[model samples]
Target: MELADRVQSLTPSSTLAITSKAKALKDEGHDVIGLGAGEPDFNTPSYILDAAKEAMDHGQTKYTPSGGLVPLKNAIRGKFERDQNLSYTNSEIIVTTGAKHALYTLFQVLLNRGDEVIVPVPYWVSYPEQIKLAEGQPVYVKASEENSFKITPEQLEDSITSYTKAVIINSPSNPTGVLYTKEELQALGEVALKNNIFIVSDEIYEKLIYGQQSHQSIATISDDLKDITIIINGVSKSHAMTGWRIGYAAGNENIIKAMTNLASHATSNPTSIAQYAAIAAYSHDENEIEQMKLAFEERLNKLYNWITSIPNVSCVKPDGAFYLFPNFKNVVNHSSFDSVDEWVKQLLEEEKVAVVPGSGFGSEDNIRLSYATSLDNLEEAAKRIKRFVEKHSK
Candidate 1:
């Protein structure tokens, strides 16, 4: 049987591959502590769940507009205005299956053959692969640990060429859990504005911030820049609604319309009940959000302290998000193990801990460990990692 040439260009997400292996061990009655998952461990908040239930009871289980229902769009608009200080009318917003889908749709709408997307190294596993699947090239602008895993405006400018179509900015970024400061975002925005390139800001973790700092969306900096920015956000991380799969994008009306048209022929609409749940999520109590933020902060502190205890492991304490992208280079090439993948595989096989290797995220010598598990499990996972590193560090 023949297969598409594109399939040869794609790789399975290493994060999910490790996750599946860990799940298989757990099913076989092993006590595997999985710290690889990217989603929050918390259940979807009760009010949001109740909203979904009520929607189902009220017979709201039909198809919706491909972009989203009018109320959800309006709620999303209000959210952007109140939170990010970016205003978007109904035509400028579209809700999709998840932020991933929102991004894939945007790539489909925007990319042509030979088009390039500048993605920083240590990127979310899907970004470059998705770009390839879209028939666009992903040009990675590598950032070092010295810069706290952030790509500079100069790097952004340098990566741009005549065929460069967009740059992806994942604030409170996925693997590194690094949040770009307002100054940095503005600087990058300046480059995008100058080059007349689109900026796809993945602000999915905006509501999950840990410290005193708040999220500053790039589009909010200026109306002039807003037209070229696509803000991808969702309820998955913040509200612990990964299964609900409700995500949205706000940007220029033309792009939104294109994404919606693409979605209509693809997904038709995001789940109707989930959309209703998202309405509650966007309009829910501030207190619930505050409580979740506090809990995440506590977990972040626990993981940060524990990571430092590992002999050669060091991590940046993220201002937001539930991940700690620790550098284990000292143990990587120096280890008895051949590669980071081998080290992680041995740990999963021996210590019963599951973590995604940094190589999977474009950083070969580092690894990402999520603290979105239970407090007890986080403690155990950290303990296992520390032991593994110490034994392998020679």
Candidate 2:
């Protein structure tokens, strides 16, 4: 059998592969601990779940609008105003299956065959792959560990060319959990505006922040840049509704309409019940979210302290997001294994702990360790990881 050339050239997700391997080991009677997943371990809030149940009971299961239901869109608009301090109309938003799908649709709608997108190194694993799948070129700009795994405006400007179509920014980023400050975003937004490049801001982890730093969308930093920026968010991470698969994006009216048209042909609309649940998520009690945030904060502090105790492994102590991207190069240099991929494989085999290699996120000699698990599981995983480093480091 023959497959399309596009599909043939793609690589499966490394994170999911690690997760599957861990589950397989567990099934075979091994005590494998998984720290490779990107979702919050918390269950969906009861109010959101109740809303879904209510939607089902009311027989609102039929097909909705091709974009999304008006109520959900309105809810999303309200969220932008209340949270991000950015306002948008219903027509300016497009709801998709997930933030991943919102990004996929944005790439497909905006990129042409030879267009180039500037992506920072150690980015979310899906960014470059989705760009490739859309027939656009992904140009990677490297950022050093000293910079907290974030790219500067100078770095971003150095990567631009006539063919540059967009720059993708993820704050409280996956794999790194690094959040860009308002000053940094304003500087980058200026560069994007001057160059006429679109900015794709992935703010999925906005609500998961800790410490004195706050999450700021690039669009909120500048008015001139607003029309060119596409802001992607979802209730998955913030509300712990990953399985529901509901996400939305706000952008220029034309771009949102174009993305909606693309979404119409692709998935029609996101799940109806999920959309209803998402509306509740956007409008739910703030105290419930605060409780969830506090729990994550407790777990994050525990994991950070445990990880810092291990020699030769240093992390940024991110302000947002539930991940710790530690630089493992001191222990597992390139010469230690054939590649980061092999290093991760050997670590998984030897320690029975799952982590995603940095290669998947456009870097080497690092690994993304998610803290989105139970405190007990995290403590145990940290012990195993520390032992693995001690045994492997030269």
Candidate 3:
């Protein structure tokens, strides 16, 4: 039998593929430094682990409500209020399996056949795919590197049509690590409001910012903007709970209800013990988050400098997240590679340093190198990348 048409349209994730390949190489005893991972390298904090243990000891391991544990929802509600002074009732919240799933569920519920979601270029690799899986059309809006990889309000307005249902905004965006300033978001939010398009704000990397960069939630711009915005976030990145698989979406009551209903048939619920741990994650002090952020900032600074030092490599200094997306078009041209993907593969094979090509993120000329690993690994990886560039330079 033929597979479903949607299955045929789907593209397997390139980020995970590269990371998996690097792991296989390492397992074969090859010295491999994989920079394709999107999670924090830190372990979940002791408080959160203790909470999970307590929940299990208290027999809280059973399934939760299809939405999530009531306490976890309350904690998530409190988090938004604390972080952005943004209020979201439990009815407007749905804890999900992960931030990725939150986006998936949001699209599933929000889109219908031929509905369009405007995705900025250099997006998280999954945005377009998730939209497509929801039977929605993904209209790509290129956010050029010259513009600091941010889509202008004019670009957003130009992309919208009657079929446009929503536009995704990933502040401290993955791959590029660029943060949208408050002013920039205000402009975009105004356009979104004017165009009557939902704003899917992915703030998964909110807590992992670098020097002088603050996270701005488009929802917090105004009550109107807040009403039309869906915030996707989770403990995976912020609390280093990637293994725990806890995330959430907060927005309009109707949309949240729809997402909760879909999640019931889909995931049943997020893990109950993980929900308990997330309560601790949200209620606790910010100490653990600070330390992780500092580590990433250090690595980002060092790696950014190291990678940019290579001949013909140029990078935009990012304000948030743990990635350095360097434009290697010049390097690729100088090194005689036909494409960025070819250069990435050659670097991995010849130098055993695996970095994700930017092709998957909608920028064919750039590549994303994650610094979410140890200083030693990152430093060595940078050295390998530099050497690879030098060796391949014509």
**Whole-model Cα lDDT per candidate?**
0.89, 0.88, 0.92
What global local distance difference test value does model 2 have? 0.88
How large is the C-alpha RMSD of every model relative to the true structure?
A: 1.1, 1.4, 0.8
By TM-score, the best candidate is 3
Off by over 4 Å in 1: none
Q: Any idea how many clashes model 2 has?
A: 0
Candidate 1 residue pairs that clash: none
TM-score order of candidates, best first?
3, 1, 2
Higher-TM-score candidate among 2 and 3? 3
> Please, what are the lDDT tens digits per residue for candidate 2 over residues 1-394?
9998878988889899999999999999998989998888878889999999999999989898878999999999888898878889889999899999999999999999989999898888889889999999999998778998899999999999999999989998888888898888899999999999999999999998897878888888668888899999999998999999999999999999999999889997899999999999988777877777888888889998998888877777878888888877766662367676787898789999999998888778788888888889999999998887777676
Q: How far is candidate 1 from the true structure (C-alpha RMSD, Å)?
A: 1.1
Clash tally, candidates in order = 0, 0, 0
Q: Give the TM-score (vs. native) of candidate 3.
A: 0.99
**Residue by residue across 1-394, what tens digits does model 1's lDDT show?**
9889888879899989999999999999999999999888878889999999999999999999999999999999888878867777899899999999999999999999889999999899999988998899999999888899999998998889999999999988888878888899999999999999999999999888876777888888888778889989998998888999999998988999999999999999999999999999999776877787788889999889988887767777787888888887777766888887788899999899998999988999888888888889999888888787777776
Worst 10 residues of 2 by lDDT: 330-339
Error of 3 at 273 (Å): 0.5
Off by over 4 Å in 3: none
The TM-scores, one per candidate, come to: 0.98, 0.97, 0.99
- Lowest summed lDDT window (length 10), candidate 1: 310-319
Candidate closest to the true structure, highest lDDT: 3
